[model samples]
Target: MERSVIHNLIAALPVAVVAVDHEARVSAANVAASALLGENLTDRPFVTVLRHPVVVQAVDAVLDPAHVSLPVPDPTLAAVGSGGYRNRVIISARGRDIPAEVTVSALPDRIGALVVIEDSSGIEEAEQQRRDFVANVSHELRTPLTAMIGFIETLRGPARDDAAARDRFLSIMETEAARMNRLVMDLLSLSRVESEERRRPAEAVDLTMIIGAVVATLTPHAEAHNVNISLIGAENEALVTGDPDQLTQVFHNLVENAVKYGGSGGEVRLELSRIRHEPALRGPAIAVAVIDRGEGIDEMHLPRLTERFYRVDNHRSRQQGGTGLGLAIVKHIIGRHRGRLRIESVKGQGSRFTVILPAKRDRR
Candidate 1:
């Protein structure tokens, strides 16, 4: 392949590639580099454009020839840092605020420097998410487990001789056991939604039917909370093509949350409608909106509401028996359906969660 062809191939490989001259001016860039670092980097210095503190340090280290060795925190990003002629640095980029894995290599016979950038934001974010998940899961599980253990110990050691004491301990144990069961179920549901999201499942499901079923299931919970949960515009069927089980879970999560977290005795409404214009989709879309008359979400926290294990109020969420995975599961399910999830909230009024899915294609 010619030089342009080679550059094009590398650029097309999803790795951001930039070559800098001895004077630190951009010698060449691949398509990925231009797209990631911006389209205007042909004659600019790589450092001046990227401006990541970590990258600057790595490039300086590679060109110095005096620094014998330097460290790159991540082993995957260590390839460039280990070599004297080249050093790899993990840096956060401006505008996008994305962390990139970059490798800087000096050309043979001191020609110039080769810089390769890879956006590691997804991988790094996933790792951090895993750590947070483990910590959250551990803490969640420990609460009920500790309570059950203490109750059991009291019943077995002293309360064993007293019927009244034994009865009280058993009652407490039941509640703790129930709490544990709820946590495990939510965790399993979250895992199932995430695992199945990567592969698209084609099954024709009626939106009205799914909404009705979810409402029926949550009726008792709604009644207990003195709240009304009902499906609106259910007279006509709205069809959506996706996994029924996952979609049902999405509906259940949203409705159940309305009862649990929405304001006391407020109305929880579910509506199914169609949108002719949605920028995220190519054509007409099917939209499902769940409106709640509860204490709404803060505008600032709206963007991060879908993050796993994220809570608006940790103490209140735990007290209300929430696992904090409901919204995250809703997000993954919508993603599996190739849809968009939008949350609109007002501090004192309420919240409306909208899920927009592609309309089923017709065949003659």
Candidate 2:
């Protein structure tokens, strides 16, 4: 094959590819390889371009048939540090270390060898997120499970003959179990919302109706705390393209949070308005603000409010039956609708959580 044809073939591949000559010099490199190892890789010694010791060793072994059987570094151990026979290696490129899976194959007829590098940064990040998610879920579940087990043991033994103690322990166990259930439910909801975040909902939804339903649903709970929940603005139907159920969930979570955290005997207001432009939305949008009159969130905690299981007041949140995933769920739901969630708070005053959704343009 013509050299240009060969180079074009290599360039077409998604992974980085480089060919090394018998003298250990890079004879050919695809665009991806150049981009990965830096430009001007052609004719450079393979060792100089791939500085990782393990990667260099793997390439050298592939080039030299005699050392083909030489054991390569263990990939698991190689991942921990530089250099190894491992399939995964970290290569320094443009002052940044990139995680990549390396594959070395010897060419036919004692020719040079080919090295393919597949970037694995995204994979590693996703794996890390999975690990963290599992750990968080385990910790959340364990707390309640441990409490329930202890109560069970007490009920079965020490509190068997004590009706008052048994009753109290059972009540506590029930509460713990309920908490576990809520956490599981919230986790499921979060998973579903995240899975659908990239797909915009096409259904036309009325923000007014969604907010109204949410207020009606949470009114009793708000009344119990002497916190009045009121819906203001947008007398007409404020329509937006979204999923009604998810929109309902979005407002429910926000309004419920407002009522729960808003100070006792205070008012929680849900305000809606049509706007021509919102910086976050970048177009005409409908903005819904769930404002509360309770002790406001500190500025420091505002940025992390939408993070999963992040709580400003853990004890109070647990006491109030908060799953700690409410805002996280709301955030995801809003994102699915191509909307933005903005949090503004001031100490000792109140907080406002706003949702800005793009307005459906008139097709006329």
Residues 215-312, candidate 2, lDDT per residue (tens digit)? 88899988888888888995898889999999988888888888888755289998999998878778899999999988998999998998878999
Off by over 4 Å in 1: 1-13, 20-26, 31-113
**For all candidates, what are the clash counts?**
4, 6
Between which residue pairs do clashes occur in model 1? Answer: 80-87, 80-88, 81-88, 263-294
lDDT of 1 at 148: 85
* lDDT against the true structure, each candidate: 0.77, 0.83
In model 1, state the lDDT of residue 145.
Answer: 89
Q: Highest TM-score: which candidate? A: 2
RMSD of 1: 4.4
TM-score of each: 0.79, 0.86
Q: In candidate 2, how many Å is residue 282 off?
A: 4.7
